[model samples]
Target: MNSITLEKWSDVVLPIPARYRAVITRDHKILFHETDMTPFINQDQRTFREDFMMYQFDGDNIISIVIKDMPFPPTHFDTFTDGTLLLASARCVRTDDWIQKNAGRYSLDGECLYKFVLGDGISAVAIDDEDTIWAGYYEEGVYGNYGWDEPIGSSGLVAFSSKGEVLFRPHLPMINELYYLNIQKANSIFAYYSLFSAIIHLDHFGRVQHSEIEEVMEVGPITIINESLITYDYHSKLLWSLKKQEGVYKKDKAFALKDQEGNDLYSEESAIRIRGNWLFVLNDSGIYRVELTMRMLEE
Candidate 1:
């Protein structure tokens, strides 16, 4: 396997654990949601009064803002093309009565614009070119036993317009777990469901174009670089290039990631966001920015 070197640019240790999700916005802002575990002192004895927090960073400085009007904590979030923030909270054991108003959009100043309710739970979401939002819902079973068994119910994908209008909703089969959601430059949306080891691709119109299933130990986030679909395997620490061939996504290239001192960089439970030539990785330890150089091979 080809090995790539990762030079750390800027590292920031979050005040709270950012386990839910993380992404770099279009305007070069870093945003991450603190997990439900960080709010309460004790998990067993809970007050249920704590609200989830979303933190933003511009360069290396943290942006300070007091969010007093948020209904619920955000489990996953992404910034719209127009700088608005879209937030979603999954229905889990940690969620309480406030979860009824789980999904919504907020301004950069921490003001809520619109709020909506989701049935099952939202695991991940991404915004497309036309400002359409694509969301992946997870079944209750997936949360049970840490997604060991197949998803109990059939929860699917949903698309919403910028004006908070439901554009389309498609029901999928028993998805074990929806790991992440991403949109390519061509406006095609891609979602990773770990239970079946599948990646479902939807076109700009929210139509299913293909469902590619492969046997892999672990799957993380998916990002499109130069029109190529790239995904990381947490177990192997290998970056794979997925190419569409024969109406399916096939692994084309693989690269192993290593730190400056040649130590293997473990990607377990890590989230990745691509901005220009930089790739941001967030894990339990800290946040890291890697300058990436894509090498083209002869066909």
Candidate 2:
């Protein structure tokens, strides 16, 4: 069996542990949500739940992260610029003041602010090249004949402007359920959907690209490593890679195997961000690095 090597980075225990939803702005930044059991005491019958949290870093020091305040719990958050933060939850959108006393506020006009409620919640969000907001639906579906339905039904990929105007909503294949989706930089967007046993890619227009399994890796969490697409599988517990180079694409299988130094070739339950020949995979345990190679798959 071929083995992949994964070296330990940092296992800094987070203040509140939660599911590793997805990472944004590469391994340099990450986002997660924590729910507090405190019930809303107001007459509105709203649950006073603390939803989202973002951990910021300069290298590995964890410079800043949004924590819970008194009445409101941070729902979802993303750093659009070094000074600006776009934060959200299920009901409302707000801009966080980095210079202020951590007050969750929006400088944008209130008339421009709209109630952006998601189906399950705002799964993933990205500002595309056109300054449009690309939000991925946070839902799942079953595979094969027993259950071949997606959670959002026809709402696979949805696009909106900065002012919260719904721009484009397109449907994907009925069998394909969204797994992990995000915007690559701003020019091109990537969406992964499970067609039961396999995964496929959908462009910004919600059009399915190459459906062949050999052409793309199966549905799992993915990261952009330079020109390659990397993913980790929890079931078989293996790591896979696919390269989309100058008009050509290829695939490679990676796993955890020990070298002379007792390091792993890859990581488990981690997020990988690849640039050039270097790959960075990080989890609660911390970040790791690996060298990658690209070769033509001979027929």
Residues 1-299 of candidate 2 have per-residue lDDT tens digits of 45555554546543333334324443235544444524532313132434234555434665434444323344444544432445544222222321111113232221112333332334556665455666664344122111223222246556765555667766444534455555545435666555443333445565545333445334455654445666655555566666555444456555543433765534455555433234456555555555554441111
Query: CA lDDT of 47 in candidate 2?
Result: 29
TM-score for all models, in order of appearance: 0.74, 0.61
Task: Assess each prediction's global lDDT (C-alpha) against the native.
Answer: 0.60, 0.45
What is the alpha-carbon lDDT for the whole of candidate 1?
A: 0.60
Q: Give the residue spans of candidate 1 off by over 4 A.
A: 33-53, 92-99, 141-155, 171-177, 184-186, 206-208, 224-229, 243-250, 267-278, 283-286, 290-299
- lDDT against true structure, model 2: 0.45
Q: For candidate 1, what is the total of clashing residue pairs?
A: 0
Query: Evaluated with TM-score, which candidate comes out highest?
Result: 1
Q: Which lDDT value does model 1 have at 87?
A: 77
